[model samples]
Target: MKTTSITHRLADLGGAKWDLHTAARDRSDRGEDIVEMTIGEPDVALPEPLARAATRAIEAGRTQYSNGRGENGLRDALAESYSARRGRCFERDNVLCFPGTQTALYAVMQGVAETGDEVLVGDPLYATYEGVIRATGADMVPVPLKAEHGFRMQADDIAQRITERTRAILLNTPHNPTGAILRPAELEAIAEIALKHDLWLISDEVYEDLVFEGNSFTSPLTLEQIADRTIAVSSISKSHAAPGMRSGWAIGPRGFMDALLPVSETMLFGNQPFIADVTEEAVRAGSTVADGMRQRFAKRAQYLADRLEAETVLRVHRPEAGMFALVDVSPLGMDCDAFAWALLENAGVAVMPGSSFGAHLQNWVRLALTVEDAAMTKAVDRISEFARSVAVAAQ
Candidate 1:
């Protein structure tokens, strides 16, 4: 019997990061002490009020299917929150909720882009973006973010890559892997380019609430001119530490959102009612919980940066906003994949290789700040030792 072949688009999709994660888990299951700093998951729990709200909704029989767009009250709450943040009038019609931010992003891509179109993406982006774009039958045009520019995506670079077939620009602030936050000027520049090119701007602001001191988050929707073309996606998964709840949303112009509703409905008939309840409570409670998490993450980021700087040969690019540090490990005379896998196997510490993010990052590795202080310290010590060993071997 012959089996059906998998689609080419998905064949080469997942990154080595998942393989490392599985290896780490296997090591732990076998009683090996492994320090995991690979995945960008917060070592925090859901806020008490939000969790209670979810429980209440479940007990109250709010488990039935909700409106395809989302729960009415939840959509209103998200719209109000975004309206306050973006300084614009956003109603329920402008917001669409989903089980996860990933789905929301997919819906936006599917809504705005068609087969054979091109979407510009910043290099060293969140790993999933590439797969999501390709899965939509669209090609991802990478716009490199140089380390010299502090990994910030430049508008001029994006402009140089735009073609008649380009349909959208995927922007992530407080970006994953590098933790580079886009400044207001940069946002303005990109928004202008998008406006001039008549391209949709898909802004992934999932890390918006995770910014540190002196760095801030800006949304393209804040620009009045591009508001109609921007789809700002975010969630409580990272900020509220409720990844398991799978609650997220996309806010955009009414017309675009109306177009997205059918796609969202076909993909996820509706969000889980209990999760929607939790998300509504979380949103209405405002950013207090997220603010607290941000403060903690800032301190942890500094701690890890200091450790890597002092002990390892890796050149650490300390994050300004998100919970990750992109460290260049070229000095160790090994590419990122080799360095990461060898360190995990020999030192029992796991981190994501830069190659997992993109080709331009082959010499770097990403350290997540989600590990606890004690575990992070241990991991750093092991990483330092591994770096020293590599340096000696290269001599």
Candidate 2:
């Protein structure tokens, strides 16, 4: 008998080696406190009402598996929530609930992407998109988002890259690693490409409510022409500050739900009823849950931007809106990976390398302002010290 190894498609996914667990363990072993600004973990508490709802559901013995499409009431509530919150309308039939947006994204990838099909992704994108695409045995074609363009993907560049092999376009609004939101004209252009290419438009709008600076999020689902081709993925993770709840939904056309349900069912039995019930309650509570979270993240974003501006070696892209700030560290003469490691080991501040998002950006780094204020401040202070030292040495 021959010994078998893991599959080939999973071989080249570099970022999945996120050793935060090992890093945390090493820090504990060294008895040194670390300030983490790498992971996008919300430091805020889940809405009080959501917590109460969860507690009530548990008390009411709502801890069983529910419909794969979600409980009827919860599904209806999600439709209403999206219309009122995101300005996107969909029938209850359009929504498919999942344990988390990650699952929803993965399901979409598996549903539409075939072996060796190509996925057009914005470079320096959310790191997970690469892994998900590869796991589906699809090729990831990274269309680099330029720093000069505020890290937003240009429609012309995306159009140039689309090939006959392309199956879908992956989009993340209020983009991770760079808090760049796509402008309306750019969005309309993308809609045109999707329509022209007859490709699936899978958008991760989990940060939909986190917009600021008067830059509202634009969802692909809102476009009438592109609506059928667009699969919208969102979660309570960022908006409700409820990552632990693991509640999310995918909304698209009725055919999408029909296709998605089988994949979701075969992989996950169903969305957790208790958590879904709580999320339903939170959504029904309307803007109170989502907008309040955005206001809190806005304050934190400003705090991080102020600190980065004081640093000499980092070229901070003060995000218009979102819970992350992108800093170009090319001036420090260090690649993103090396700088990230040095920040972790020397300064005790951990952040994500822009290279992890995609290949074109190896000199930029991302700081998640979602950490608690005191710790975030400490992380910024450490970053400032490192940047100052680099600047002085260059002089």
Candidate 3:
């Protein structure tokens, strides 16, 4: 059989998931016990109610297909939560359920952007957003967010990048790799740019609940005007430590959502019915479980930050919220990739290179502070020792 020709866009999308695999392989080859702080995978147990809900769903034979949009119960639950948090009235028709936020984000980009169109992405982003935009043959225009700015994207920076080809702006609150939470004023500025340029705002709020230090999470959906142009994407993966559940939803204007339904129909046909059934239970009872997980992550983040403060070589950009610390190791003067590899080999520590987030930050590394406090403390000690040795070698 003749092989089908792969598109050029697919060529640009490979190796996105290689960081974790590389860390795992390096640890195995060295016969070392690695404390993984690379991926944002929470090392917490799944909420007890999630398992019960899943068991009941499976017993009820909900293993079929759900509506392409989503089951009404799950949609209602999501909408209710949206209303409670953002004070926005969302209807079941305004939501679409998918396997996870990844699929939901891809579908939204596919729906709104055409080939060669441009998406304004904040640098040091979630990493996968580039792949999603590239897969659609759209230009990923990265606007850098400096560590000096707490990795927050300013509105003026976004405005300078806007052009006729720009179709959307991707926003991640309590952003991954940095934990940069866009405050209300910063979000307002971005919203104004979106409104002025007529750009769609793709708001990724998966980490909204995991905020720390009493930082408030402000959503674009809170603005009545932007609600029509905003696509608010969230998932159960991070909030309840239920990544196994693989359920998420996109809440936005009905018109924009309708555009994405065709993409969903072509890709997933419909979301998993069983997962949707369990998702209803999660959404309804998520308040307590989600809050508990946030508190645990807050404790872990604090422990890691406190340890980082004692290290002379690395500087941690302590975020007011979220599960990560964007650590700058420029004082040691090694590229992030090399630093990460050396740490893995010598200290048995695994971390993500800031280069994974964007090209401008070659000297920065990202540490996921979501692991258990004990594991994180040990990892910090390993990193500090590694930094000291590097310092001595330089002299």
Give the whole-model CA lDDT for all candidates, comma-separated. Answer: 0.86, 0.81, 0.82
Q: If the candidates were sorted by their lDDT against the true structure, best first, what order would they fall in? A: 1, 3, 2
Q: What would the per-residue lDDT of candidate 3 be over residues 1-395, giving only the tens digit for each residue?
A: 65433356666556754665475667667776888887777667787777887888889998887778988889998889888888877888899999899988988888878787999999988878887888777889999897678788999889888889999999998788787888789988898999998899999999987887567888888988787899988898887788878899899999878878888889888887778978888788864466666776677766666676676567777766666777778888898888888888788888888888888678888887767778877898999889889989999
Provide the lowest-lDDT 10-residue window in model 1.
1-10
Cα-lDDT of candidate 3: 0.82
Q: Which parts of model 3 are misplaced by more than 4 Å? A: 1-6, 29-31
Q: Please report, as a residue range, the 10-residue window in candidate 3 with the lowest summed lDDT.
A: 3-12
Per-residue lDDT of 165 in model 2: 94
Across 158-267, the per-residue lDDT of candidate 1 in tens digits comes to 98999999999999987988989888999999988988889999999988888898887888889998988989888988888888888999999999988888898898
User: Which residue pairs collide, candidate 2?
Assistant: none
Q: Which candidate is the best by lDDT?
A: 1
Q: List model 2 lDDT by residue over 1-395, tens digit each.
A: 65333255666666454665358547857888887677776667887888888999999989887867888878999888767755766679989988889988988899889876999999888877887888787889999899788888888999999989999999988788787898888888999999999899998988777787577777777788887798888888887789998888888888978978888888887777888888888777753555655666677777766767765657778776667887788888888888888878778887777777778778888887777778777887888898888778878
Give the TM-score of each candidate.
Answer: 0.96, 0.92, 0.95
* Model 3, residue pairs in steric clash: none
Q: How many clashes in each candidate?
A: 0, 0, 0
